[model samples]
Target: MPEVLVQYQAEIWQAIGETFIMVGVSILAAILIGLPAGTVLFLCRKGQAFENQVVFSVMNLFINVIRSFPFLLLVVFLIPFTRVLIGTAIGTAAATVPLSIIAIAHYSRLVEQALLDVPKGVMEAAISMGASLKELIFKFLYVEARSGLVLGLTTSIISFISYSTIMGVVGGGGIGDFAIRYGYQQFKTDLMVYMIVIMIILVQFIQFSGTTVSRWIDKR
Candidate 1:
């Protein structure tokens, strides 16, 4: 292989590793927080079990507001909190704060929507069968929406990857940061192009794998 090609491959792999780390941490946090928040949102929705407009609206406003902020800006806004949590706000670990926070809001809304997509009759049948809230949650809602949840999770992972790249602005070094630092910032056109191509390929590979697995896991 060409010397430049070999060098690019090494840097590309390194950047990919960082991206994976950020996305992995964010996805775990998103699942932990998003699932419960979504469940609460669904339960509090109008005409559902434990319905409450006040609760639903409050959560709705909060989630929407959190999700609406641009990811890069959110990173800047969360610097203090990130530093407090990670002991520094300019590394792979610190990058996870914004990634995870944004993931929670992003995935929570997706989870809520997925639950809403579950047919109302399914819940009614469960209720008539004398199901408890726990039963409804574990068996009915999630079980029925398992496929959609997978897709939602896939979406969250993709979003997390994109957001993680922006962490470069704050020195949250990753492939993106490497590209910016050595490629664009240094005016190395070839390096910049290589990074862009690798990033695109990585995104494509992730999206393809995620979609295929999600479809396979879907019982329906």
Candidate 2:
């Protein structure tokens, strides 16, 4: 091992664990809340099964507003709310508040787009077969859009990892935070490069896995 890695192996491992916690929570929020929210958005569109212009407009506007904020600013802006919810806006837990909010917004838009890509004929066919709303979605819509959904989730996870990097501003230490504090601040350029390389490898692995799984499951 390089001198830098040997010197900071423990810290590096701790940082990785912190990053996983933040990203894991964000992923959970994305799937549990964002997925349903996107489904609702799709259902409420102008001509969908549960079409309601008012609901669609309000939800669309809300998502747009959330996504419009620059991520750094969004983190600072949510400090008070984070404190209220997590009892402090200065740690990994507090950082998750903003990460999760952004994850939901980010993943939801992609999910909506993925669902939109499903052919209208699929819906019509499901309805013609007397499929209920739930059955139509499970048996037709989601099935057809599975690959896109997986791809969107993979994309969202990458973004979440990127977002987690900036959490160091709030003392939410992760690998990025470690690099900034120990490597950049200390002028250890090689260390910083190593951290960046790790991140690149992590992202590449995730993308490849997601793509492979998507292709394997995709029927059309």
lDDT of 2 by residue, 94-201 (tens): 999999999999998998999999998888889899999899888888999999999999999999999999999999989899999999999999999999999999
State the weakest 10-residue window (summed lDDT) of model 1: 1-10
Model 2: colliding residue pairs: none
Candidate lDDT (C-alpha), each: 0.86, 0.95
Name the best candidate (by lDDT): 2
- In candidate 2, position 63 carries an lDDT of 93
lDDT (Cα) of model 1: 0.86
Using all chains and alpha carbons, the TM-scores for the candidates as numbered come to 0.92, 0.98
Per-residue CA lDDT of model 1 for 1-220, tens digit only, reads: 6556576777667777888899998999889998899989999999997899999999999999988898778899999998898899888888888888888899999999999999999999999999999998999999989888888888888788778879887776777788888788888878878777877887788788878977887777
Q: Could you list the CA RMSD of all candidates, in the order they appear? A: 1.7, 0.7
lDDT of 2: 0.95
